[model samples]
Target: MTIILAWYRDLIELTMSSNLMTMVQPGAFSNLIQIGVLNLRLNNLTTIKSDSNSITNIQSGAILNLPKMRELNLQSNQITDIRPGTFSNLPNLPRLRLSSNHITNIWPGAFSSLPQLRWLDMCSNQLTYIQADAFSNLPQLSYLNLASNQIATIPPDTFLDLPQLMKLVLLNNPWQCDCRMVAFSLSSAEMLTNTIK
Candidate 1:
C-alpha cells in the first residue's frame, strides 16, 4: 500500500496486478500529481473512502479531478446512488466500468459531462428507473450495458439521441413488455437484445 501511495503521489498510473487490497487508507491518493488511468479492479473496496483517512463518505471529486484520466474501474463494489456531479469533471474519460455493483438510481445529469465517453457498463446492478434525457449528451457513446438490472419501464424515445450506438444490452431487466416498451425496443439495433418477463 505504501508503494501504491508513492506511485500515485507521483501522478503515475495505478495498476492492480493483484486483487489483494481489502482495506484502503483515506487521504492516500487524492492529490496525486497527474495520473491518466486508474485501475482498481478485483479489489475489496466497499466505499471509496474520503481524503481524511477517517473512512469518510465517498467524494465524487476524488476521481473527477484526475485531469488526464481516460478510464476508471470501480467494478464489483457496493456503490448505490450516484450523486449528481460525480462524473462532471472527467471530461477526457472514455471508458467507465461500474458493472456488478449495488447501484440503484442514476440521477439526472449523472453522465452529461462526459463528451469523449464511449463505453459505459452499469450492468448487473439494482437500478429500476431511467429518467428522461438521462443520456442526452453522450453523443459519442457507442456501447452501453444496462443488463441484469431491476428496470421495469423505459420511457419513449429514451434512446433517440444515441444514434451511433451499436450495442445495447437490456437483458435480465424485469420489463412490463407493453406496447410502448416494444416500440422503444424496436428503435434499438437488432444487435440489442432484451429478456422478456
Candidate 2:
C-alpha cells in the first residue's frame, strides 16, 4: 500500500513496498503529519509491526501519528482484525475506508479515538462478529457501510449512541431478523425513515 496518498492530484512517496513496518521508519510516518489525506489502498499489507519489533496483524501504534490527517484509504487488504487504540492519535480523521478486506473481528474500543469521524466504509468484508457498543466512540458518524458480509445478527445497543447516523447499508447479509432482533429491526427502520426526511 502507498502511504501518504494525498487528496490533491500529486502523490507522495510512491513506492512498491510490501512490508508495512519499514515505511521510512523506525521513525513511523513522522514526516506525513502535514498531509491532509493518506491512501494506502491496494497492497499486500498483511501485518503491522510494533515499536518493540513484535509482529501483529493489525496496524495500531504504527499509525498513531498524523494529527492533521483527515481521510485514510485502506481498502482491499488482508486485514482480519482491528485492535483497540489503533487510531487513537488521529482525532481529526473524518473519513476512513476499509472496504473489501478480510476483517472478521473488530475489538471493543477499537475506534474510540475517532470522535469527529463522519464516514466509515467497512463494506464487503468477512465480518461475522462485532462487540456490542464497538462503535460507541463515533459520536458524529453519519454514513456507515456494512454491506455484503457474513453478519448473521447485530447485537442490541450496537448503534445506540449514533443519533446523527444518516445511512446504514446492511444489504446482502444473512440476517436472522427474528424476535430477538426486535430492537435492531425497529431502530434500523427508524434510522431509514429519518434518512428519508
User: Which structure among the candidates has the greatest TM-score?
Assistant: 2
Q: lDDT of each model, Cα atoms only?
A: 0.68, 0.70
10 residues in a row with least lDDT, candidate 1: 49-58
Backbone clashes in each candidate structure, one number apiece? Answer: 0, 0
- Model 1 per-residue lDDT tens digits across residues 15-131: 652365543444455566477777766555555543221111234654535667777777765667676566666788899988876788787667887878899999998989887
Q: Any idea what lDDT model 1 has? A: 0.68
For each candidate, give its TM-score against the true structure. Answer: 0.76, 0.80
Q: For candidate 2, report its TM-score.
A: 0.80
- Per-residue C-alpha lDDT of model 2 across residues 111-179, encoded as one tens digit per residue: 898999999999999998667867978989999899999998887768767877877888999988788
State the displacement of the C-alpha of residue 138, model 1, in Å, after optimal TM-score superposition.
Answer: 1.1
